[model samples]
Target: MNENRHSVIVIVIIIVGVILLSKLFMIQVVDDSFLRRAERNAVQRIIDYPYRGLISDRNSELLVYNNPVFDLMVIPQEFSIKDTAKFCDIFQIEKQKLIERYTAAKKYSWVKPSPLIKQISTTDFAKIQDYLIDYPGLFVMTRSVRAYPDSIAASALGYIAEIIPRQMERDSLHYYNQGDYIGHSGLESYYEKILRGKKGAKYKMVNVRGVDKGSFKNGTLDTASVAGLNLQSTIDMQLQQYGEKLMKGKRGSVVAIEPKTGEILSIISAPVYDPNLLAGAAYSKNYNILLSDTTKPLFIRPIQAKYPPGSIFKVVQSLIGLQWGTLTPNTTYACNKALVACHNHPSPVNLFGAIRNSCNPYYYQAFRQMINQEISSNTYTDTQIGLDKWHEAVEKFGLGHELGVDLPYENSGSVPSSSLYDRIYGKGRWKYSTIYSLSIGQGEMEVTPLQMANLAAIFANKGYYYTPHLIKAINGDPGKIPEEYTTKHDVGVAAHHFDMVQNAMAEALYGTAMRAIIKDITIAGKTGTAQNPHGEDHSVFIAFAPKEDPKIAIAVYVENAGWGGRAAASTASLMIEKYLRGHIERPALEEYVLVGDFGD
Candidate 1:
C-alpha cells in the first residue's frame, strides 16, 4: 500500500509542473502582441531630411537658393527634462520659453517629432549637437532655409512661409507638416506646384534617448526627391532697373512691352522692398513692418491699380469712330476752350489734326454719332444698336474685363455698359452728354497701367496683339496662352484708319508733347492730364516709337504731376530713347526730367 501511494504522488507532481509550463508558454510566446507593443514604445522615429530645390531667373541668375539650417526636434513621448538649464544654454533659449515650446509641441502630437527651435545657423547647430548627449529628448535636424542672392524683385518673386492652417486642410497628400515652407505670392505662389518639388521619405531607427541608430530596414523604401523645374521670364533686368530708378519716390507705375510679341519688357511698381527682407530668421518682424506701411510698398501697382486712361484712351475712341464711318481722316473740330463752341470748328480739321490737338469737341461729336449710329437695319434701335456694337468692339480690345495675365490679384477696371447707365439713371433718359467724359477716357472708364501698355501694343500691331505675358518660356517651351490670345482679333476698323491716327499721334509730339520729340525717331504718342479732385492733375502718356517698325510701346503715369507733356510724356520719351538708342540724345530734357519734382 505504501509503494502504490508514492507512485500516485509522483504522477500528481508531474501533472502540476506540466500545467505551469503551458501557461508560461502562452504568456511569453503564443500571444506576443503585448510584448511587441512594449518594444515599439521604447524605440522612437526620426525623420530623414530632404534638400529644397534652387530658384533661378531666366538668365540663370540665382534669385533664391537654400542654405543649411538646423531645427531642434523633440519627441514628446520620449522627452525628458533632465538637464533643463544645460538644454536652455545650448539652444540659447530661456528655460521658461523652452518649457512653453515643449508643452505646445506635446499638445500638437506625441509620436510625431516637433520643432522646439527653428532656423538655427550651422555653427549654432554644431554647438548644440556637441552637447546633445546632455539632453534626453533633444535631437538636431538639418533643414533648408531660403536665401536670396539679388534682392531686387521682392514682390514679383515673393517669399516662402510656413503653411497656414487653411492650407493644411486643402491638400494633405503634399504632406505639408507644421513649419513647412510654402509660396505666399507672385510667381512663387502662381507656380507653387512646379516650384515645390515632390517630397520624399525614409524611415529611420532611433533609440529611447532620441539618438538616431540607423536607417530603418536599410532604407529599402526610401524615395529621392526631385528638384523643381527652372523658369525663364521675359523680364529684362537692365530695363527693370532703369524703370525702377525713374519711379523711385513716386507713387505711380510704368509698364513697357514688346509691341510685336506682347512680351513684357519691364514692369515697375514703386516703393519696392528688398527680397532679403523676407528671408532668413527675421521674416515675421519684417513682414509686419511691410504690412503696416501706409504707402503699401507690397502692392503691385502695374496690374492692381486702376487709373483714368485720360487722353491715352482717345486712341480707342478715334479707332471706333473711324470704323463706324462717322469720322474721316480729314474730319476736324476746333478746341475753342468751351464745350459748346468747341463742338463747331472754324474750318474742318482732318482726323490727323484732331488727334494731334486732342480736340475734345471732335471726340464729343464723334462719340455722340457712334451712339446714334445703327448696327443693322433691324437688329436694334439706333442708340441700342450703336451701344451694343461699341460694347463688342471694346470687349474685343480686351477692355471691360480681366486681361488674364499670369500675375495674381489683377483688377478688371470698370467698363460701364448701357445697362449700367440704366441702373444709375433710367435707361433712355440719360443722354450721351451725361457720359461725355468717356470720350476723353475719364468718368467711369478706368484702366490699369498694364492695360494701357497693352492698348499701345494693339495699336502698334495695327489692331492685333499677342496677349501680354511676363513669362516668355519655361524649360525652353513657349508659355501656354488662351486661343483668343493666339488668334488675330480685328477691331473692325479699316487699315487706313491706323495710318491716319498714327499721323495725328506723330503730330502730337510736335504739338503738346513737343518736348518729347526725338530728332530722328519719328515717334507717335498721346498725352493726358487726368482731372483729380483731391490734388493736382495726374499726368499720363502712352506711346510707341520709330513708327514704321515699332520696337517698344510704353505707358507712364505720374501722380499729381502737372501736364502729361511735362512729366509723363518726358518720362516716356527718355525711356524710349534709352531703349532704342541706348543713350539720351537730349541732355537738357534728361536733366529736366531727372530734376523736376512734383508736389505731393
Candidate 2:
C-alpha cells in the first residue's frame, strides 16, 4: 500500500513540472516587451559626429576647415561626484567650479548631455581619459571646431557660433541642436546649406551607468553623415592677401572683379580682424573686442557702405551725354577759372581734356543738355516719360537697386529720381543746376565699392557684365548665380561711345594719375576726391588694366585719404600690377601704401 501511494505522488509531481515548463516557454517567446524594457534600461544613446566640409579659394587653397576638438561632456542624471577632490585634480578645476558647472548643465537639461569643459586640447583630453573610468557619467566627445589655415579674409570667410534661439525657432528641419556650430556671417552664412551638409544619427547602446558599449545593430540602423560640399571661390588668395596688406591701417575698401565672368578676384575691407580670433574657446571675448573697435572692422564696406562715386561716375555721365546726342567726343568747353568753375584750370578743354582736368562746367553743361533733350524727345513727348526713360537706363546699369550678390547684408545705393526731387523740392521747382553734382557722381548718387567695381566691369565689357559674384563653384558646378545677371541691358549709348569715354579716362590717368602709371601697361582710370560734409574729402579711384583686353577691373575708396590719385589710385595700380605680373617692380609704391600715413 505504501509503494502504490508513492507512485501516485511522483506522477502528480511530474504533471505539475510539465505545466510550469510550458508556462515558461510562453512567457519567454510570446511576450518579449518586458525584456526589451529591461534591456533599454541598461543602455543609453550617444551621437557620433561626422566630418565637416572644407572651403577653398579659386586655386584650391583651404580657407576654412575643421580640426578635432574634445569636449568633456556629462549626463547630469547619471553623474555622481562621490570623490570631488579627485575629480577636481583630473579636470584641473576648483571643486566649487566643478559643482557650479555641473549645476549649470543640470539647469539647462538634466537628461541631455552638456559640455562641462569645451575645446580642450588633445593633450588635456588624453590626460582626462586616464581617469575617465573613475567617473561613471563623464565622457569625451570628439567634435569639430572651425580652423582657418590663413588669417586672411576673416570677414569674407566669416565664423561659426553656437546655434541661437531665434535660429532654432526658424529652422524646421531641426538640423541643429543646442551647442551645434552654425555660420554667422559672410560666405559662411550665405552657403550654410551646402557647407553644413546633412546630419546623421545612430542608436548606440550603453550600460546602466550611461557608458557606451557599441553600435546597437552593428551600424546597420546608422545613417552616415555626408561631409559638406567644398566651395571654390573666385577669390584669388594671393591677390586678396596683397590687397589686404595694402589696406592695412587704413579705413576704406577695395574690390576687384574679372570683367568677362564678373567673378570677384579680391575684396578687402581695412581694419579686419584675424579669423583665428573667432575660433576655439576665446571666440566670445575676441568677438566683443572686434565689435567694440572704433574702426568698425566687422562692417563689409565693399557691399554695405555707401559713398559718392565721385569722378569715377563721370564715365557713366559721358555715356548718358552721348546717348542723349547732346555731347560729342569732340565737344569742347573753356576751362578758364570762371567757365570751368574750378580754382586751378585756366584754359579751354575738349571732351578728353575736360575729363582729364575734371572740369565741373563740362559735366554741368552735359547734365543740363541731357535733362533738356530727354524732356523734348519726340518719341516721349511728356517730360515725365522722358525722365522715366532716362532713369530706367541708369537702373539697368545696376544703380538704384540691389546688385543681388551672394554676400549678406548688401545695401542698394540711392539714385534720386524726378519723383524724389518732387518729394524734396516740389517737382518743377528744382532745376538741373539744383542737382548738378549727380552728373559728376556726387549729391544723392551714392554707391558702394562693389557697385563701383562693377561699373569698371561694365566699362571693361563695353556694355554688359555678369553680376559680380565671390563664389565660383560649389562641389563641382558654379552654384546658383541669379538669372538677371545673364540679361543684357543697353547703357543707352552706342558701343563706340565707350571708346571715346575710355580714351578720356585713359588721358585722366596721364593728367591726374601720373604717379600711378605703370611702365608697360596702359590703364584707364578716373579719380575722385568726394567732398564729405562731415569731415575731409574721401579719396576714390576706379580702373581697369591693359585697356585692350581688360583682365581686372577695380575700385578703391580711402576714407580721409587726401587725394584719389595719391593714395587710392596708387594702391589700385599696385594691386593690378601684383595680380597681372605676380610681383610688383615698384617696392616704393607698396611701402607707401603699407605706411598708411595720410598726414591727418
Candidate 3:
C-alpha cells in the first residue's frame, strides 16, 4: 500500500512540472508581447528632421529663412519629476499646466514620445536646457521656425504652423506627424511637397534613468535625412519693397511682372502686416490681431479683390474691334452727340486719338458696331451671336477666368454671358443699347489685379502671353518654369494691331496719362477711373517700360482715389522709372506721392 501511494505522488509531481515548463516556454520564446515591452524600454527612437528649403528672391535676396527652435517632448511612461517647483519655474509653466500636458501626453501614448510644448525660441531653450536633467522623460528636440530678414512679402511668403489632427488623417502619404510644421498658404502652401524634405530615424540605447547612452546597434539601423531643395522666387525684393512703400497709406495693389518670362517682379497689397508678425512664438497672437482689424491687413488684395477693369479695358475693346474687322486704326467715329459723358478730350478722333484721349464716344460707337454685326437678318440672333463671339475674344485675353498664377485663393472674375443676359432680360429681348455701358468696361466686366497685370504682359508680348508665375527658379534651375507657364497663349489678334494700340497708349502718356511720362524712358500707359458706389472712383493704371524690348509690365489700382492720373498713374510711372532707371530722378514727384493722401 505504501509503495503504491509514493508512485502516485511522483506521477502528480511530474505532471505539475511539465505544465510549468510549457507555460515558461510559451511566454519566453513563443509570444512577442514581452519582447516588444523589453525593446521599448531599452531603445529610444529619435527622428532626424531635415531643414526646410530656403526661399530667396530672383535677385538672390533672402525672403523666408529658418531660425533654430526647440520642441519639448515627453515619454509619459518614464516621466519622473524630482522637484516639481524647479521644473515648472525652468519651463516657465504653471504646475497645473504641467500636469495637464503630461496627462495629455500619457493619454496620447505612454511609451512613445509626443510634443508637450512647441516653438520655444533658441534664447528660451538656452535659458532652461540645463534643468532638463531634473525631469527624466522630458527631452529637447531641435526644429526650425521661419524668419523674415527684410520683413516684406508677408502675404506672399506665407507662414508655417504645426500639423493638426485633420492634416495627419488626410495625409495620404503618412508623411507628417502631430508636431510637424507645414506651410499653410501662399507660396509656402503651393510648394509644400517640394519644400518639405524626407525625415530619417535614429535609434539610441536608454537606461532606466531615460538618458540616451549611445547609438543602438552601432548606428547600423539609423537613416540619414536629406535637406530640402532651395527655391528662387521671381520676386525682386527691392522692387517689391518699393511698391509697398508707394502704397504705404493707400488702399490698393501693385503687380509687376517680367513680360518675357512671366516672372512676377513684385506683388504688393496695401495694409500688409510684417511677415515676422506671423512667425515663431507670436504667430497666433499677431494673426488674431491682424484678422480682427477692420482694414483687413491680412487680406491679400492682388489676388483676392476683384474690381472693374475700368478704362484700362478699352485697350482690349480696341483689339476686339480690330480683330472682328468692324474697326480699323483710321476708322473715324463722330463723338459730339454726347451719348456717354465725355472726359474733356477732342471729339471726332481717329483710333489712336480715341485711345489716347480715352474717348468715351469712340468706344461706345465701336462696341455698338461689333455687337450689331449682321450675323443674320434678325437683330436678336445677330446680337446674341456677336455677343458670344465677343465673349470668347475677351476670355482669350484671360479675363472672366482665373489666370492660374502660382498663388492660392485666386478668383475668376465673372464674364457676362448670353445666359446671364437671358436670365435678366429674356432671350432675344436685349440689344446693344441695353448694355452699352459694357462697351466702355463699366457694366458687368470685372478682373483681379493679377489679371490686369497679365493684360499688360499680353500687350507687351503683342498677341501672345506666357501665364504669370511666381517661381523664377527651383533648386538653382531656371528650367523649373512649369510647362503651363511656358506655352504661349495667342489672343488670336494680329500682331500689328498691338503696335497701333501701343502707339495710341504712348500718346496717352502725353494726354490722359501725362503724369506717367519719364523723359529718359518712353513709357506707354493708360488710365481709368472706375465708378465706385461706396465713395469716389477707384483710380486704375496699366503700363510697360521702354516701348521697344519691354521688360517689365505693371498694373496699379488705388481705391476711392479720383482720377486715374493722380495716384494710380503717378505710382506706376514712379515704379517704372525706378525699375528702368534704377532710381527715381524725379524726387519732387516721389515726395508728392509719398506725402499725398488720396483717401479723402
- TM-scores for every candidate against the unseen true structure: 0.85, 0.88, 0.92
Task: In model 3, state the lDDT of residue 55.
Answer: 94
Instruction: Single out the weakest 10-residue window by summed lDDT for candidate 2.
Output: 375-384
TM-score of 1: 0.85
lDDT by residue for model 2 over 1-600, one digit each (tens)? 999999999999999999898888777888888778976675455566666668889898988889888889998878887778877888888777788889998997665678888887777777778888787778787878888877888878888888899988978987778888888888888888878877777777766555567878787777877788888888899999899889988888999999888888998888767898888877889989999999999998998989988777777877877777778888877654453346366456777777888887777677666765544434223444545656777887788888888888899998888788778887567665567677677888888999999999888888888888878777767645446545464555677878977877887887788767999998989998877887878889999988988999999999988789888998999999998899999998788888977552
Clashes of 2: 2
Q: What is the lDDT of candidate 1?
A: 0.75
Local distance difference test, candidate 3 = 0.86
Q: Per-residue lDDT of 1-600 in model 3, one digit per residue for the tens?
A: 999999999999999999999988998999889988987788988999888899999989899888998889998877888788987878888899789888888887777778877789988998988877777788888888889999998878888887878878889999987768898878888888888888999999877656668998899999988878788998988888888888888888899999988889999888777888888877788889988998887788899888888888899999988988889999988775568888676768988988988888888999989888787899887888888888999999998988888888888996797888999999999878778888878888889989999999888889888888888888999887678878889999999899999888887878877778899687888998988888888999999988888989999998888888889999999998888877888898788788866542
Where's the lowest-lDDT run of ten residues in candidate 1? 340-349
Cα lDDT tens digits for candidate 1, 165-246: 9888887575677678888877777777766776666666666654567876687757766666566666666666666677
| Local distance difference test values of all predictions, in order | 0.75, 0.81, 0.86
